[model samples]
Target: MTTPSARVVLKPKRARPLFAGHPWVFAQSIARVEGSPEPGDEVEVVSHEGATVGRGLFNPSSAIRARLYRWDGGPLDDAFWKARLETAVQLRRDVLGLDARNSAYRLVFSEGDGLSGLTVDRYGSCLVALFSSLALHRRRDAILDALRELTGAEGIIARPDRAVAKEEGLDVGDVRIVGTIPEDLTVFENGLSYKVDVLQGQKTGFYCDQRENREAVARYCLGKRVLDLFCFTGGFALNAAKAGAASVRAVDSSAPALATARENARINEVANVEFEQGDVPKILERLKAAGERFDVVICDPPKYAGHARDLAPALGAYARLNHAAVDVLSPGGILATCSCSGLVDRATFRDVLANVAEHSRRPVQILEQRGQGPDHPVSAPCPETDYLKCLIARVG
Candidate 1:
């Protein structure tokens, strides 16, 4: 291994997590820096006993002081990046067969793909890259080059997350265009086609992570009344409709999303879906007051808690949402609920569901527990990668 230009020594007993293969090294664990290193520069991490732990990108400005990419202290050069990008793309192509059925899929899943703070999603001929760390943003050019060479994509766009960029103190430009990208492109998933607005759409145009979950939920919707809450772009609702649901009412707070969902219904020739725009909680209350009940209800809200500090309130919000969902569910009805908050673990989410069922006076039996599809693989060392949690239960 080549010697790094700078070094960080961990305080006594602070190197245990690093030895255990945890990628992050907090600022508190760093005792000292041997040489001056600019933010995003590669640095060697050393234990207090003088043994090298690993090499990683260093940024003193952030709470996460270092993000180790390799434990063997390999050189982080152009070749290394190219090889990693190639391996990631090949895995999607060979293992997942992403292009066989769909043109949209996750190409790199940050820590899951061994590239922390970086995510790349492919939509048709376009590739959208999101950089959540200063180090990855600084090395975007090399990464983009590798992606272009490996995928032969028509265009590559940078979609830096605003909140994360602010937290990391990175000044990333907005919606950088690398090549030609269409304003509207259609992609196929699970035998369904939907139009995607890559530039303005949420999170790389669509929620490809929910691909498998939507298909799974469709099985229970056949000939049943379905209610899809927070139904952005009608992924679940449309799938339920395609599965021969007697009726499907999809609700969302965004008018634009509802408009897109309507268009999706038209394109797929699914006429059983009704799109409604309003606050989900208020709509649920109104539906309950009107004695509206569904055989299958899907409650998939956005992340309620982004950090650990907000877990308490987030749990309350989740419980309320599930309670409302359960209250509107008919006897022997199925409820497919989801939480995307990384701070809320699966066990805690299950507990929240149990509490909701208890408070609503509805007994429920667990049907299935699901998560993000295979393309968004989770790294065992990084629990944050395992964020999406979907629980399917039958309420009596």
Candidate 2:
């Protein structure tokens, strides 16, 4: 093992999180740097007592000053990356049975796979890699090489999260293609096929994190009228239709997404689903005013809160969105509501649901609570990895 050129020393007694296996070393915890290290450089992290804690990527510009990748002192090389990627893929295949029903699944879930800020999703033969940190972005070549060698994927693409890049003080360009990226890529989830525009799709072309939740929501849709809010590409709507929904109305503000949803519905030969393009909140109010009611309503909105400061407003927005969804639900209807905000804990989300039920004048019975699919595993020490929350309740 080679000695790291840079070293980060933590403040007095501030290495508790690192010792506890939490990967992030916040700017506040860092006391000083012993060597000159640029952003995206590997650095040794040590406690105030001068005991080595771990080796991590240093980013002085980010609030997360350092993100530990290895607790044991070792060099990060081709072999290391290959082992990490292989281990992540093996877990998905063995534990999640990812290849059995779905061609699209999260192969690596950032910190969950011991690789912070690097997410790789497989869309059939294509692999979409998202680098959220400057450190990972800088090592894209090595990572992509390992991915190609391990997965034997036909095409690999890089879609750096613009928000994350901006936060990390990195100026990243447009999406870069590494191999022969097919113009139209289709992936299967729960035995349902949907076309993926991997080159220009949302979050690696599809939201594979909600794969199991979508399937689970289908169980209650049999012979029921369903409403899928923010139904991007019709994952839940199609699943519900496949489960024998009487009628499924999928609503989203994005015309392109709705078009894709319609295409997916046609491809699946599911005629019960109707795609609508409009503001979801306004459309919900319109549906309520028109006396339209659904037996099963799903509200899976995007992340409302990204940081601590946005928590208050996000709670309010979630409450309003859920209230609107509940207002259009028939008595004894099922509501599958979700929040993908990491800042909002399960308790806070449940509280928001309760407040929505109260405001909507509907009493709710909790039926089931769900998180992201098993493929998107969460690390015990990193709470950020546990983001998605879905609550299924019966309202009357």
Candidate 3:
């Protein structure tokens, strides 16, 4: 018998999701490997019936055996990659008009932008590109070239996703810098200025995903005392303070992030925001004891669940923090809570909030449910891209 070459054959009935346009192919669903394929190599995916499903980057180290990029069985060459990159850029620039309003925004949202495992956020003239896949990381040079040409960026910084290094078998060492990067990079969002440290700051120097949410949540902050927990770089706090909030108190564990937030406040002349650095749970406990209350509270914490196994504990932690938030919330107060973990779906997080309502015995009325902004577009076929869950509710 002749060899079928390097390809991944799916088990019976496992091709449904791939056929449905889902990008990831789990190892468990794979029936067999027809040929030996190196990591980050282009390989075809086939069903048990010998029908060609698609072709994508094959990674044996990660649980996701393959991340298919094309459904029409196209080649993933440099031109193909550049076309995908251009499409992502066009969405932010032409479709969303993100650049016309804000200099800092998500340019490419990994799987959300059809480029699985790669995300590029523009921080003013400096562009920060994060590589989550070995295949994408290998093609950083070509990708950065396309990005620089498309955006006319002054500098490009290629950073590794250290969180996924172990799982994805990545080498997390140093960041590759191209072109000239300003020592002090600042970005504007919703009429607020923030100093971004692309080399040292959190998640590409800023959390641009919450840009719209900050503006939306601040509307309720006017003439109300607002508390922002896990307020990294004071995104929600500054917005609330600027929106005429009575006073804003923000808490975070990272001293560097708080320092940046304080600096942002200083530069923007926003003096109403007071930043406290400490563990959030302990701070929440202290606030409850102090009998402090706020009319509007924003809880935007870091990712609690990194994997499926951590989902239970993440839920427990969320329930604890939210219950504590409810403790400090006044009757009929607004609570803007958020979860960044993709594993914690909207339904599951809602279930947690339901439990919180039952335990605290408070009437929970959901005002609006939001997700990552349009810049972080969600692929309908890939629900995993829709990771963020923001719930603005009234707690009694």
- Candidate 3 TM-score versus the reference: 0.98
lDDT agreement of model 1 with the native:
0.89
Per-residue lDDT for 275-367 in model 1, tens only? 999999999999999999999999999989977789999999999999998889999999999999989999999999889777888888889
Better of 2 and 3 by lDDT: 3
Q: Count the backbone clashes (under 3 Å) in each candidate.
A: 0, 0, 0
C-alpha RMSD by candidate, in order: 1.4, 1.4, 1.9
lDDT score, candidate 3, position 262: 97
Query: Any runs in candidate 1 off by more than 4 Å, and if so which?
Result: none
For residues 245-309, write the lDDT of model 2, one tens digit per residue. Answer: 99999999988888899999989889988889999988988998999999999999998998879
RMSD of 1: 1.4
In candidate 2, stretches whose alpha carbon ends up further than 4 angstroms from where it belongs are: none
lDDT (Cα, tens digit) per residue for candidate 3, span 177-200: 999989988889999999999888
